[model samples]
Each structure stands twice: as C-alpha cells, then as structure tokens.
Target: MDFYLTALLQGLCLSGIALGIYISMKIFNIPDITTDGSYTLGGAVTGMLLSNHLPIGIVLPVVIIAGGLAGVFTGLIHTKLKINPLLSGILVMTGLYSINLSIMGRSNIPLLNYTTLFDSFHFIADLNWNSLIVLLFIGTLLILLIGYILKSDYGITMRATGNSEKMVSALGVNIDRIKIVGLGFANALTAVSGFLMTQFQGFTDINMGIGIVIVGLGSVIIADTFINWMNISSIWISLILVCLGAILFQLVLAFTLSIGIDPTLLKLITALFVLSIVSLPRLNLTRN
Candidate 1:
C-alpha cells in the first residue's frame, strides 16, 4: 500500500508533463517527439543550476524558457524551412541530446546533497505526506493555468490553427506565429515537469527521458478512453481527466511491479496500454 501511494504521488508530480503532451498532441495536433529529449534538457539545466547554488524559484523559470527555446527552434525548422513536424521534432530532440550532455558536463547529475522542493517539505517527510501534498498543489495549479490559457484569445487562435491552418490564415490570423507560440508553450510545460521530477527523485539522468513520449501518449489516450472524449464538456474537465489518467497509469505500473514484473518491461507495457486506449474508439465505431 505504501509503495502504491508513492507511485501515485510520483505520477501526480509528473502530471505537468502529461498536460504538456496534451497541449501538443491534442490542442495543437502536433506529434512532438521533442518531448522525449526536452524533458531531459529540463532536468540537466535544473540540476546544473541547483548544483551551482541557484535558488529553485529562479532556476525553474529558466529551465522552462530553455525548453521553450528548444521547441521554437524545432518550430522554425518545420514552419520556415518546410521540414516535416515529426522530422523537425526528431532533429531538435537529437540536438538536445548533445546540449543536455554539455549542460550537465556528464550523463547524469546527482541531487543528493542539493536542496530541493522536497527538502522544503522535510517536516512532512516523516509522515510520508509531503510528496502527495506537493503533487496535489502543483497538479491543481497546472490544470487551472492550462484551462485559463485554452479559453484565452491566443489559445483560440492556437486551436483554430490546429483545426485548419488555411481557415485560420484566411481569417487573418498568423498561423505560423500560432504554431510557434503553441509549440513553445508545450515544451515549456514539459521542462517545468522535468525540473519538478528531478527535484522529487533526487537525480537527473540524460537517458531518463527514453520513451517518455509513449508514457505521455498513454496517459492522454487513457484519459480520453475512460472519460469518453465527447463527455468532456469543458477544458477544465479534460485537464482533470488527463491528471487522473496519469495517476492511474502509475498505479498500474506499481501493481505490475509488485507482482514481480520486470521493471525494464515498463516501456513495452506503456506502448501496449496506449495502443489499447487508441483502439477503443475505433472498436466502438466498428461495432456500430
């Protein structure tokens, strides 16, 4: 039970990344492979900054900006150079692999001796409550922030761009600018998630982001499947479903591990789970 609770908290803590994935894949209709690398970029930047005695409050925003800039570069390649979005994402992700290495000066950074958000809640550590409490706060804040953004004028333009670039452009909206802003925002949120995750886990590894896009897609697909995407009457509800889906995914992982499942098989399990969720809608359609 304790282990399950821990996994649940960890999932909640990483909900920011899931939300970021939702923005890119669902809101912007972009399948960004950059997330798998930018997540590590966030951790590398945050861990390096924290090691240099930088305050979390300051370093956190910087990490997010760094991630955003990475996304902007990818967007530029796609929009300006006519590169495919998938290929552009892969190119930027490949570049970030080297950049993250350069930032850390190594493949990983240990945060054992550094102060972090978890340390600030040391008082609750004894009770095993801090992780859950902190995750709840961060997850709630992210959901609210995303909901607000989705309702804003800029957000509407972003959605329009995703729905129909030609229509949005005909309406005098700068579709390229919308794509840039949307992708930038998506990567920034992903970076914030990476920063918070390193703080929680006490270490950052360059390869930690391996298959992260699968995990994020799994979470989003699970949310859409369980809630019946059509039932999501508002953006807020959709965000909440995404968070819940992440928690559920973690719980499933925890359960599998408890049953002596090989931990290394997690990526395979994530892929299968995503496939099942994605096929659910089609199954219903075929049955009808």
Candidate 2:
C-alpha cells in the first residue's frame, strides 16, 4: 500500500510532463523532441538555483520561463527559418544538451540537505503528509490551468494551427506566432514538472530526461484509448484522462518491480506497452 501511494505521487509528478507533451503533440500537432532536453533543462536550472538557496517561488517561474524560451528557439527555427518541425525540434534538443550541461556545471546536481518546498512539510512530519499534499496541490493547479488554456481563443488558434496551418493562415491568424506561443507554453509546463520532480527526488541527473517523449506519448495514448477519444467532452475530462493515464502507467511499473522484474527490462516493457496501445486501434480496424 505504501508503494502504491508512492507510485501515485510519482505519477502526479510525471503527469505534468505528460500534459505538456500532450499540449504540443495533440493540441499543437507538433512532434516535439525538445522535451527530451527541456525536461532536464528545467531540473538543472531549478536544482542549481535551489542549491544556491533561491526561494522555491522564484525558482519555479524562472525554470518555467527558461523552458519556454527553449521552446521559442525551436519554434523560430521551424517557422521563421522554414525548417521542418521535426528537424527543428531535433536541432533545438541537441543544442539544449550543451546548454543544460553549462547550466549545471556538471553531469549532475545533488540537492541533499537543501531546503526545498517539501522542507516546509517538516511541521507536519508526524503525519507524513507533505509530499502527497504537495503533489496533489501542484497537480490540481496544473490541470485547472491547462483546462482553462484549452478553452481560450488563443487555445483554439493553437489547435487550428496544429490541424491546418495553411487554413489558420488563410483566416488571417499568424500561424508562426501561434506555433511559437504553443510550443513555449508547452515547454514551460514541462519545466515546472521537472522542477517539482527534482525537488521531490533530491537530485538531478542530466540523463533523467531520456525517453521522456516516449513516456509522454505513451501516457496520452493510454489515456485516450481508455477514455474512448470520441467520448471526450471537455478540457477537464481530457486533463483527467491524461493524469489517469500517467498514474496507471506508474502503477504498472511499480507492480513489475515488486514482482522482482529486472530494472533494465523496464524500458522494454514500457516500449511493449506503448506498442500494444498504439496497435490496438489498427488491429480493431482490420478485424472490422
């Protein structure tokens, strides 16, 4: 039961990242590889700042802005420079590798003994309620914010840009601007997630973001599948499915570990799970 609860908390942390990716992939219709770098970028910046005794309140927004800036760079390369979105994302991600290294000044940053947002929970240590409460608070705030964004006019423009850039342009909307804004917002959310994750885990590894895009896509796919995409009604429901998908994914992983599964095989299992979900719809189509 303790493990399950722990996994649930971890899932909430991961769900933030998944939501960010969904904004880019589903809402913006852009295959963004920049998440691989931006995720760690957020962690590195947050961890370094917090280690230097910066307040969590300040560090959070700074890391989010930093991630947004990274996304803008990628968007500019794609929209202004006429580069393919996929290639643009790859280039930006590759560049961020060096950028993240420079920010951390090392391969990793340790947050041991550092006072973080979670440290305030020491007052309630008798109940051991800090981490769970914090996770739920952050998760709920993010979901509400995302839901609000998806209902706004700008959000509709973003969706239009994703589905048909030329059509949006024909309608007098600056598609380039929409792409940049959407990408920036998407990465900002990802950064916040990374910030929370590092503070919660007490360390930041440069390679922590590896395979993050896959994980994000897997969560979205799983959620959409379970919720029956056609039945999705509002932004709130979409956000809920995304969160549930991430939590369920983590639960599966926790169960596998409890059964003595090799840690190295975990990636294989994740890949298989994603593959199965992705293939299910196609298989059904063929059967029909």
Candidate 3:
C-alpha cells in the first residue's frame, strides 16, 4: 500500500512537467526539449536556495523565473536566429547542464535536514500521506490555473499560432512574441515539477533531469489517449486528464516494480511503453 501511495505522490510531482510538455507539444505544436534542462535547473535552484536558508517564498519565484529565462533563450534562438526549433532546444538544454552544475556547486545536494513544501502541511498523520495531500492541492491548483489561462483570449492566440501560424501572423499578431511567451511559460511549469521532486526525494542530483523529457512526453501521450476516447472538449477536463495520465503512468511503473522487474531495465521499459502509447492510437485509427 505504501509503495502504491508513493507512486501516487510521484505522479503528482511529475504532473507539472507533464502539463508543461502538453502546453508545448499540444498547444504550441513545439517539441520543447528545453524541459530536460529547465527541470534540473529548478531542482538546482531550489536545492541551492533551501540549503542556504532562503525563504521558500523567494525560492519558488526565483526557480520559476530561471526556468522561464531558459525557455526564452531557446525561443530566441529558434525565432531570431532562424535555428531549427529542435536544434535550438538542444543547444539551450546542453548549456543548462553546465549552468545547473554551477548553481549546485556540486553534483548533488542532500536536503534531509532542511524543511520543504511538504513540511507546512498536516492534513494526514503519515509523512507520505501528508505529502500526498500537499501535492494534490498544489497539483489541483496548477491544473486549474493552466486551464483558465488556456481558455482566455491570449491562450486563443497562442493555440491559433500553433494551429495556423500563417493565419495568426496575417492577423497582425506577433507570432514570435507568442511563441516566446508560450515556451517560457511551458518551461516554468517544468521547473516547478523539478522543484517539487527534488524536495520529495530529499536530494537534488545534477543528472536527475536526464531523460525527464521522455517521462513528460509519455504522460502527455497517455493523457491524449484518454482525452481522445472520452471526446472531452472542455479545457479544464483536458488539464485534469493530463494530471491523471501522469498518475496512471507512475502507477504502471509501480506495478511493474511490484512484479520484480530488474531495476536496470526500467528505462527500456519506459521507452517501450511510450512507444506503444504513441503507436497504438494511430493503429486504432487505421483499423477504423
């Protein structure tokens, strides 16, 4: 039971990143790989600030802004320099590796003795339960916030930019500006995930964000599958499904572990699962 509960919390932790990826891939139609670096940058910033006794309030905004800046950098490269979007993300992500290292001043930072966002909550007696409650609240709030934004006027423009960039441009909208803001917002959410995970795991590792993009992509794919099947058109419902998809993804991993799979094969399993999710939907369409 505890194992499963942990997986639930883990899902909540990853929810922010999943939303970030969804915003980029689904809304903007941009494969913003900057999530890889921005996630770790969030952890690095959080860990460094907490270890230095910084206020939690200050720490969070700083981490979010840092993540946003990284996205802005990638957006600039792609839009201003005319670099391919994928290559621009790669360049920024690669640079963030070194930046994260410098921020941490080490390869890892332990937070066993420090207070975290989980410490402020007491809705449950068990540590894990309390953590779960806090995570659930935060996750719900984030999903609502994103959902609201996506249903707004600016969000219409952002979504339109992805769906018909040429048309939006023809309307005298600054496509480049929209892309920058959208990407920046996406990465900021990714960074929030990193911040939460680092605190939950009790340590921050320089390489923790490695391949995190894949996890986010998998969650998005899973969410997309369910959303399509339900034929849900409400933005709020879509956002909720995205978070549920993250939870479902984690639950699958937990079940896999319960079955005694070799830990070394976890990455392979993740890759295979994501591949299946990506392919199965198209296969179903073909059969229809």
Candidate 4:
C-alpha cells in the first residue's frame, strides 16, 4: 500500500513535466529536448537554495526562472541562428549539464535533515500520506493554471503558430517570439516537476533527470491516445487527460515492480511501452 501511495505522489509530481511536454510537442510541435537538462537544473537550484536555508517561496520562482532561461536559450539558438530546433535543444541541454554541475558543486545532495515545503503541513496521520496530500493540491493548482493559459488569447496564438507557422506569420504575428514564450512556459512547468520530486524523494542528484524525457513522452502519448479516442476538443479536458496519463503511467510501473520485474530492466520496459504507443496508431492507419 505504501509503495503504491508513493508512486501516486511521484506521478503527481511528474505530471507537470507531462503537461510541459504536451505544450512543446503537442501544442507547439517542437521537439524540445531541453527538458532533460532543465529538469535537473530545477532540482539543482532547489537543492542549492534549500541547503542554504532559503524560503520555499523564493526557491520555487528562481528554479522556474532558471528552467525558463534554458528554454529561451534554445529558442533563441533555433530562431536567431537558424539552427534546427532539435539541435538547438541539444546544445542547450548539453550546456545545462555543466551548468547544473556548477550549481550543485557536487554530484548529489541529500535533504533528509532539511525542512521542505511539504513539511509545512501536518494534517494527515501518516507522514507520507501528508506529503501526498500536499502534492495533490499543488498538482491540481498547476493543472488549473495551465488550463487557463491554454484558453487564453496568447495560448491560442501559440497553438496556431504550431499548427501553421506560415499562416501565423502571414497574420503579422511574431511567430518567433511566440515560440520563445511557449518554450519558456513549457520548461518552467518541467522545472516545477524537478523541484517537487527533489523535495519528495529527500535527495537530488545531477543525473536524476537522465532519460526523464522518455517518461514524459510516454505520458503525453497516453494523453494523446485518450484525446483521440474520446474526441476531446476542450483544452481543459485535454490537460486533465494528460494528468491522468501521468498517474496511469506511474501506476503501471508500480504494478510492474509488484510483479517482481527487475529494476535494471525497467528502462527497457518503459522504452518498449512508449514505442508501442507511438507505433499503434500508425499500425492502425496502415491496416485501414
């Protein structure tokens, strides 16, 4: 029971990353790999600040800004230098490895002895359950905020920019600027996941974000599956489905572990699962 509970909290923490990936890949149609680096950057920033006795209020915003900066850098490289978006993301992600290292000044940091945002509340009987509650509240707030943004005028334009860049440009909109803002917003959400996960696990590591993008991609794929199957047209409904996808993904992993799957093989299993999701639609199309 405790194991499943932990997985639930973990999924909620990572839902932010799923939503961020949805923005970059689904909404903006940009394969921004910067999420790998920016996620670690968020953890690095949070760990460093908390170690120095910083307040959670300040720490959260700063970590978000750091992540946003990484996205903006990738956006600038792609837009200004005319680099491919994939390569631009790669460059920024590569640089962020060093940047995250410098920020932490070490490979890992443990926060078992430090106070975290989750410590502020003591409403639940079980400590782990209490943290889960807090994470639930935070996750709900994040989903609502993102949903509101997607329904806004600027967000519509961002979606338009992704759907038809030439048409958006023809409308006299600065498509490049929209891309930059969209990427920045996506990365900021991803960083929030990093921050929450660091606090939840009571430790932060430089390599903790390695291959995290795959997990997020899996979540987005699951979300897309539901959206297509249900014919979901509302932006809010789509975002909610994305959150559900994140939870379901984690639950599936938990079930795998419960069934005695080797931890070493978990990555392989995850990759295979994502590959199946990616290929199934195309397979259906071929059959048709």
Please give the lDDT score at residue 13 for candidate 4.
92
Task: Flag regions of model 2 displaced more than 4 Å.
Answer: 121-128
As a TM-score, model 3 comes out at 0.98
| Clashing pairs for predicted structure model 3, backbone only | none
How many backbone clashes can be found in candidate 1? 0
- Give the Å error, residue 93, model 1: 0.3
Using Cα atoms with residue i matched to residue i, what is each candidate's TM-score against the true structure? Answer: 0.96, 0.95, 0.98, 0.98
Clashes of 3: 0
Q: Residue by residue across 113-152, what tens digits does model 1's lDDT show? A: 9988777665474534876777788788889898888899
- Local accuracy of candidate 4 as per-residue lDDT tens digits, 56-95: 9999999999999999999999999999999999899999
Evaluate residue 251 in candidate 4 and report its C-alpha lDDT on the 0 to 100 scale: 88
Q: Please report, as a residue range, the 10-residue window in candidate 4 with the lowest summed lDDT.
A: 117-126
> Ranking under TM-score, best-scoring first?
3, 4, 1, 2
Which 10-residue window in model 3 sums to the lowest lDDT?
115-124
| Top candidate when judged by TM-score against the true structure | 3
Please report, in order, the local distance difference test score of every candidate based on alpha carbons.
Answer: 0.85, 0.86, 0.93, 0.92
Provide the RMSD of all predictions against the true structure, rounded to 1 decimal. Answer: 1.5, 1.6, 0.8, 1.0
